[model samples]
Target: MKQSKVKWTKSVGWLLFLMAIGFFCLQIGYLIIQPRYQVEYIDNRIFYVINMLSIICLYMALLFLLTWKKIWTVVVTTMVTLFIIVNVVLLVERNKEVKNISSISPNLQQIFAIKQDTETGEAMYYRSYYGILSRPKDRLEPEIAGDYKIEWLANDIAAFTYEAEDQTIQQFIGTYGDRQEDSMSYYYVASQIRGKWGADNAQVERQNNGIAITVDDQTELFGWDNVEQFGTLAIVLKKNNEAVWAISLDENFVANSEEIEPTVGNISLYKATMEENDPIVLAYQGGAF
Candidate 1:
């Protein structure tokens, strides 16, 4: 009877050892596939806690095999229970975040797919606006050479006009397309837009001298039926700023509506624009744009 009990305990320990190894493998595989998902907004406290729990599980699994004592067995069992409880809590929170993201329409979801340059880690994300594929440049670090101001026309929409040293007036307007709850830092979004539609392929329109990346109509493309509501991010840049203004309009307003402004978020954006007195200070603002 004693020999049988010892054999059974050893088998259980080996099974736990295999589980520990599997857990580590799974974590590594996930990291390899999805590096962006690791970025945490609530600080990294939760990440550290998870790492600590994983370490404890590994230690307990080792002790279970090294020592058959009842005290060690109890400790291993307790640690496993704790690990399971913590993981369940985290999984629930992750599900909630997923639900929030799912609220976005499928057509819009496809527009946000980000591709990163392996060497530079720079990302390129773009969306089709009307028939044009609009994207931002890598110059996320906005240069405040002279007097310039970014005014928020709405909670998720903003506009700015500036004149470069070469007497060229630059105008840029953008909308926060992602849901407010899941919107990433401005820097992340800018990085994602930097290179998807390169400037080379884009042709400047004769009317506004603003560049547009055009594409043929596709059934799979979002906004094929109703192109207005599916608009994600739109920017109209004018060459030499010749009476140029790009306004994003949804179902609420007609295209080229002089009164309409760029819109974002499900909630109606407030019609308020806050002017930043000192534009150079934006360099220190750090990616919150």
Candidate 2:
């Protein structure tokens, strides 16, 4: 009877230990999954979960070892073996996916898939006349008293300057004077404006009745004039001299990315327009694909 009681106590203790390990692994999983901006963290979390599960199985086997219980030993051994096999398979797949995403036609897929593909009947982005998402918002030095002020913009009738939160914004194509009931009409005007800018930048674009299609501009975007274009600089759609929608290249427009916390190049942090319907966030994990 005493020996039986000891065995029972051992079972309970092992159960608790296994439970604790599982819980710890879950916490680690949360840390990895919640931070959507990290690619590696997501991958790491997956591996750790498998590892924890394996440990639990091994621990159960050890408990059976103590009691010389054949059934328990078999169960634990089977669990461990299964988990190890699973982890190996997943690790192989994970590595393959990472390599392709980092190397292949990353830019083309991001832009076309997230926004440009009209066949999907999805529209998270709109074109812009003035390059609102073009350059990083000019900001004051860390020690300086000045803050991020949207100071100046190139003078053009197509695009005008406005103010919001001390940020002087270059209003692209939309209804500056009056709002239009038809959203398509507004987009048309903005497209024309974008076409004009494309020319100034020495790039060519196609303007349809209400749709403006932007082609590739010959100029180098990043590292031009010793400036790096982090995310993307795409066209903005305007109507009645107001911006209706602003289209981003690979990802959404990011505001002052150079100054934002947890900074990455062209991560599509936020929209500069402050519109209610800003472009959606695809994945914060990688910037501009």
Candidate 3:
């Protein structure tokens, strides 16, 4: 029975020693690959704790195998303590250098995050498709600077505007859905009208999913499915199977006009129910137009 007990102790000690060696090799591999790639941990603190525990296990295994050797215990304990302290300092410094700003889409189907390096003032944008578990984030804007202003052009389209380091305004679009899927047959018409148009207090924005009309603090949305185009001359917006608004383009405006910019055009807005009312002329402000 004494021999069997000794054999069991040897087996357990060897097993733990193998595990500790495996963990140590993994740490070395991580260090080698870390500079070449960006490594993400779901929980950083837990990862550090696990590594520290593995080092402790190695110390315990060495003590068991060598029958409580004093030198092995002291050296391994000191190494383990130093490992913990170094990892803790690295984690704290990393947290201080990086800042994450995130926002959820209006439909709650997607999430966008910006990982900004505070020291260098460099920012990278990422997006994730939300599901039971969100997939790995896909990198969007690789490098940008300054504060970001996000606007949802549609449920799946985000427009990010920011002032560059050179003090010029720049915009980046994060489109999660296919443009063809939403516009379909009226793709050209949709493309032409997709922008912000204004006339005094009234504003019209043709988005990926819908047309947003705002007047004197009141806004109404007409889904793309409810919008009808009559060539490039005009478009009618419908709500509940009834025409609510009509937009008529300039008579001289040609779909293929080389003289005119895509974003520059004149348009008139009239209440479909009351055509007698004076139409509003809206000038193109921004977007695809």
Candidate 4:
């Protein structure tokens, strides 16, 4: 009976030790891949839940290793229960706060929000525009007093700048004026058309001056300015040997091809536009191809 009791104690200790290691690995992995955007709200929720569970597991493992007894087990169980309840309450409050903020600040478009700890008042603030997902709001040091205030300013800057860029692209594309609702990039739009029509002989070429389209024995050229003539850009698609839709950059406009993030270049292609005739229209507003 004495030997059996010793063996049981060793087995319990080893099991708790292994569980602690497993929990630690889980916590490390979560930290690595936690979502940073409000667009990934589901992922954010899962990360938080897993984090809380890992903490509980680690704490239980410690308790078990320190005192292998029924009382320690009871203590750990009670702590886990309390921790779960508290976390759930916090989650509910956070969801409510997010909803309220969204309704009140319709323009803010909360991509992600960082809540302050009720006890410790610390958080990492974040906001995002259409730029690369991981880019910071800004690099300049702010004159703001608090972290939250500084973050608010950063978000405002990013949003305003991105909004201006968006307006510029739209104006260049002439989406509000002569251009039809259905428009897309020349490359994608042409490929889609060719695929749909089963025209294996169709070809598209991007030249220094503009784009050239050839089908069978016929050829047509749509003129655009070279890189030196910044902002003189246009996208054209032809179907049945005729131009379907075309948009060009305004002559007065200047191209801003500066990179937003490390690898992502400036905005060039407008999003895929669909027309009544099922044509995909894309506009080359500005920047490199």
Candidate 2 lDDT, tens digit per residue, 115-201? Answer: 111232221222222221111122211111112112111111111123323333333211112112234232222221222223222
lDDT, candidate 4, residue 199?
Answer: 26
> Which candidate, 1 or 3, would have the higher lDDT against the true structure?
3
How accurate locally, in lDDT, is each candidate? 0.36, 0.33, 0.60, 0.35
Instruction: Please count the clashing residue pairs in each candidate, in the order shown.
Output: 1, 20, 0, 7
Could you tell which candidate, 2 or 4, scores higher by lDDT? 4
Write model 1 residue lDDT over 184-282, tens digit each, in one string. 332222212221221222211211222223223211111112111212433342332221333332222212211133322211111112233321110
Per-residue accuracy of model 3 over 106-196 as CA lDDT, tens digit each: 8887655566677877766554432211233434333455555665444554545555565444444454543222233433445565578
How far residue 120's Cα lies from its native spot in candidate 2, in Å, is 18
Residue-level error in angstroms, candidate 1, position 251: 41
Give candidate 2 misplaced runs (Cα > 4 Å).
1-66, 100-224, 229-289
Model 1 CA deviation exceeding 4 Å by range: 1-5, 36-78, 100-289
The prediction achieving the highest TM-score against the true structure is: 3
| Poorest stretch of ten by lDDT in candidate 2 | 151-160
Per-residue lDDT tens digits for candidate 4, residues 1-289, read 9988867766776676677577667656545654543332222344457657666656655654566588867877787788778878877776554321111122353343333233332222333333212222222111111311111111111111111111221111111111112343222222121111112444444555555554564766655431111112444343332223333332232333222312111112222122222222222322323
Residue 15: error of model 1 in Å?
Answer: 3.3
TM-score of each: 0.25, 0.26, 0.38, 0.30
Candidate number achieving the greatest lDDT relative to the actual structure: 3
